[model samples]
Target: MKIIKNILFLVVLLSTLQGFSQEILTKKEALEIALENNFGVKIAKNNLEVAKNNKSIYNTGFLPTASISSGANYSNNNQTIDRQDGTSTSIDGAITQSYNASLNVNYTIFDGLGRKYNYQQLKETYNLTELEAKETIENTYLQLFTNYFQIAKLTKNKENLNEALSISKKRLLRAKYQYEYGQSTKLELLNAEVDVNNDSITLINANQLLSNAKRGLNLVLGIEKEVNYTVETNVDFTNILNFDELHQKMITNNTTLKQNEKNIAISEFNIKVNKSNYLPSLGLSTSYGWNKSQNPATSFLAASSSNGLNAGLSLSWSLFDGGSTKTNIANSKIALENQQILLEQQKITIDNTLKNTWENYQSQLFIINAQNKNVITTQNNFDRSKERFKLGQITSIEFRQAQINLINSKTALNNAKFDAKLTELQLLQLSGDILNVEF
Candidate 1:
């Protein structure tokens, strides 16, 4: 019994420790973890590695290649040969065995500059893959930050709703007391009860929304369902960005722009590579081998039983490919021109995006300020109405109107703040500066 109890205790202790070991993530930490651990990012990084390896393969063309090969054969002869004695000799060999081994080397002394152009093209391709991975990371970070801020905003909104609900409950209690003392009508108490119930429903909905938003954020972070996270709500938005500076940064640092530039370079290299096909290619190959046979008369086997070395240079020219090479070169040039056009379009699009986001951010900032003032004004009106209700100077309907107005104002203010923050984040993202921002 003692042993069983001890084992059970140890099991419970290990379970508790495992439960406690789950990560409690903050917004920054969660974003960092997602960047490092997300499946999408991992796959993108692997693709980039593949591209790099392909570049290495292209680079190997500059180096000499050597390989060793060996083989064995067995045969039964069924023929006759004339010997030096001018007599027919029967070559009745029974199970003759032969073996061969060789080391072959090949080197491209010249190849119409094809290898050089191919290597350059592959390097550009590898760089483009890296840029694509960076673009993926930027997109992921934007999504993570958006969700993070949304959760924080929802939390604040829920807190405000709870406060409003508490106020409603207090008002209900006061109305009930007044009705019992014959100082307030039954209708007044009924209205207060209705307000409390409504606030309670709203609070419940807010709680549900907060829960769903948290789950969504966790999903984005690739965390388990049981994990919990808290967002840092105190984000700074005071750093004013100049439009010109943002545009310059986007042009200089945006991964998409870099990728497009690499595409253009790759297109140019493709044209060169195709043009090189019109020229002749030169190469050298050499081989040395040894062979052995059990029947010396049937195989070329001297006392040394070896084959001599052989080396040669080869040349290959397309000469004429029915205009195929010319067509390829034309297609490559057209592609390069298209890429230039695409680059221009991309620049225009980025500029428009930046301008629109900046304008929206400015508009939201003003709305937030105005909503803040409105909240204060509505709060003051509610306070005055409350005092008047207590002194019997205002009716319950008038007091309730003031309370509803205050709630509406607070909700509007919260929404405006959330929108302002969201727009600011968008601007930062469009400018390619979101990752550099320290939350």
Candidate 2:
């Protein structure tokens, strides 16, 4: 009775674990999960939030700063006064206490529109961060597409190995029957057995590879434990690259290039901000203060209280800073030029990538086409050889060769298909179409 209950408990536990552990997802679903949970995406999102916060009016130094403070102090002292006539008066144990509180406000009235430029720069920074987040999402989708399709390829390979193993088993069975009835030699039967064993080993290795592929996909999804999951058998390869469109869009919409452009804008804004130092800055400051003093030694200073408000308009300009302002403006202009140069350089690099990826994508398509014919021919040969061997018209060695050939051909076709799919994804990624991955 106890054993039965224990078995039931174990079964229930496993059932619950399996239910909780497995997370089946389609490509779209996986992408959605990765966008929400990926560390890169989350970090970029946080940086964007920071940029947004910095673009606020208070952060851009457009609002007045106000503060209040209070203080109290007490002191005990002895004092003496002497006159030129040589008579002196002394006082002992004179104690005094004072208290004061103040409220102050400072606002910049004008600074050559530096605050406006700063605000605009911060807004641009926020937009750049937004693009950065989008880029991260796009890159993440590319990675997911890769890992997802790799599993699909491995799964196909596993199926091929399984079918090969089944054929080997059938051959082994036939060989055993022939040997038992004295219709085949012991050597042929032994060879058949070896083929079955070899096939089994290959199948096992293929299964291990499939398992590893699943584990990698799980890791990409940020899942801690392995789970039962399957991906779409078909990979997307619908869109082909049009170089003219890509080149135009590359300069206009490429996130990295746009980020570079933003950098240049910031540098231009910085020049304006620094030029503001050349002009006198005007500010208004106001304070309301209260003070009271208690003094024992003098009547005028004893128990006096006063309260008043003071306001002032202040002007400050750096007359000279050892030519640092000129140097800063020059550097800002240089930096802007540097960013522009980098944007052009990026275009050159992207041109190379597009051309090469387009070629590779085309090459893989040709390979798939070539391998399709090979697969058909190999399958025909394998079928004919199997029949001939069963009728004792061909040796087991000939049949085995045909079997291996067919397997290789099928495997090559699947590889070519997968390679083409990946290259297609790469093309999409380079053109920033991965951002629109859906359906």
Candidate 3:
């Protein structure tokens, strides 16, 4: 019977190993796929490109504008004129023709330096968009790693369930032989049968969980079709995290905080832009024009033509205009103040989050250590209990307890290890180092 049990265990192990014939999807591959295919990352990149395109001299009103225009008109008229000397002259169907053409150029030479400030504002806006894009990519990294590790966890769970089911079947088979030989009661055999049935159901549920987990990973990868693959079960823990260093990095490198800093700069530029409205503006305009007219009914001139170049300078001061400029400047100042306040608030929020995440990571690491020891102990207990049960030295219930302990310990250890990995990832994310994680 013992020889048969050993053979059964080896067969089950070999079958389970064979079931994992799919390709291995590594962490690096998952991240690379997400970089190329994730919807959020692509959208964020497009937005950054838009911001970059907007950072141009034309958009900031820093360039001159030129226009060319031409027109012609022809008309026929019946006319009658009475002179002062009591003489009258009448004409019919007199032809008239006129033509005009012009080229104009206008430039704002100075507007209290508003153009400079506007250009600076555009630059700051582009920077802010860059930070936003970085934030989105980092967030996608977190989500991808989270989903990838979840699949790994569920896969390990299915393996554990398979082993448990195998053990239950072996137990049931031994129970049958003992009862047939009149060494064990029917009650023992029935109990073993019940355990086998329960284990089978648990394994079925585990398989469903694994399938769902794989689908989740596929969604994160932006794969429209579902794919089956195995993952590397080994998770390397990061143990060198320092709260002080991480907090400092969060202040300097965190995308949200950096975006807020850019916002503050943009607000400052806006205030300058509005204040410039109070000063006088200077502009330059130049044009070249040609005009010609022909009238057969004219008394003095039959045809006339003229051409000239014109130039002018304009100076306009907003002495008073219903206080619109003043009001705008005041509003801009208020907005800048609000941005400063928000920056402070964001700092506080990030500080608290970093503290909490660091503590949780430490706790998970400790739990992983404890579970490692527990798994070892439970495995040894299960091995000894199996031998005792074969020698008819322990009851079925006692043996079942040992088996349950082993299974639970393995499950717990797997959960702990993966949970710790996730917590470590959170720490990296909070520190703005998620993209730098090692495979």
lDDT (0 to 1) per candidate: 0.81, 0.82, 0.88
* CA RMSD of each candidate after superposition: 7.9, 5.9, 2.9
Residue by residue across 1-439, what tens digits does model 1's lDDT show? 3563576467558846854774555766877878877777888999998998999964648998999999998877676767688987565654577799999999988888888899999999999999898878877887887787787787677667766776776687789789889999999999989988998899889877877887877677777655244456655674856888878888888777788999999999999999888889888999998887676464445334668898999999888999999999999999999999999999999889889988888888898889989999999999999899889999888987898888888878877877787777777767667778775
Sort the candidates on lDDT, descending order.
3, 2, 1
- In the predicted model 3, the residue pairs found to clash are none
- Number of the predicted model whose TM-score against the real structure is largest: 3
Better by lDDT, candidate 3 or 1: 3
Candidates ranked by TM-score, best first? 3, 1, 2
Candidate 3 local lDDT, 192-229, one digit each (tens): 99998999899888878877888888887887645567
How much does candidate 1 score in TM-score? 0.88
Model 1 scores a C-alpha lDDT of: 0.81
Give the clash count for model 1: 0
> What does the lDDT come to for candidate 2?
0.82
Better TM-score candidate (2, 3): 3
In order of appearance, the predictions have TM-scores of 0.88, 0.88, 0.93
